[model samples]
Target: MAKTKNPTLYLTELDVTRLEGIASRAGTAELDEMLDALLERAAIVTPDQIPKDVITMNSRVICALEGDAEPREWTLAYPDDADLAAGKLSVLSPIGQALLGARAGKTVDYRLPNGTAQRVTIVEIVFQPEASGQFTL
Candidate 1:
């Protein structure tokens, strides 16, 4: 295995269980590849590390279509449920993976279906529910 900075998986309990369900439904190898890649790249950002308004894990992500108006907001989920929702997407998905731990008003580059690349700016982030009261990083 290649060396990486953050090795521990940082998924929520719900995420873990959801991934298990996906593995059962679709098999482990596929999901394993995604998990491996995510773990290798994820920075494991704490609340303090995140910027003032960034959208992060468990935040609602609003995505604007490239050409059309009317941005769509989605409740980011893990594994396949996210895989199914239109605006909501799997953290393993290209854009979702990029948006993880990102704060609001930040822009990120990610690949699209046609092999084209695009930059997206974060407009809003509704923080994780647990982050409301506990202000510790």
Candidate 2:
């Protein structure tokens, strides 16, 4: 069988810290392995320069699917108590991780737990906080 390709991930200091916290709390080597794998995958996806469409860490944006009637808005940050009530999803989730930093019109293939591939297309980016003139950091 062929090996699966992993993409390089561009994460902010905050996300890195959070991942470290998860590793510490779990008391397992999963986090470390994930980080290593993420870096390797990122290298493959971003061999040259990262495309303009890739989302940065802490980005809040509206992502629309090609076939979906409405766009879904989400942030990369772990939602707070209030945000959770508003339908915000954590970036660590399978779907969130697949969509992170992905540009509009790009086809993203995410592997499901059952070993199936979920293919999605980024139709329109209605809004992106990083693309806008908000916090630069």
lDDT of 2 by residue, 36-102 (tens): 5554454323212334466654555565654577867765554232154465655555666676656
Superposition error at 93 for model 2 (Å): 1.0
Residue pairs with backbone atoms closer than 3 Å in model 1 (clashes): 53-104, 54-103, 54-104, 55-103, 55-104
TM-score of each model, paired residue for residue:
0.58, 0.59
Cα distance off (Å), candidate 1, residue 37 = 4.3
Whose TM-score is greatest here?
2
Candidate 1 residue lDDT tens string, 1-137: 22336532233333344545666677668667865566565444444443445444566766664554776676666654564446567766777766765556667777876988876666666555335633321
For candidate 2, the per-residue lDDT at 30 reads 60
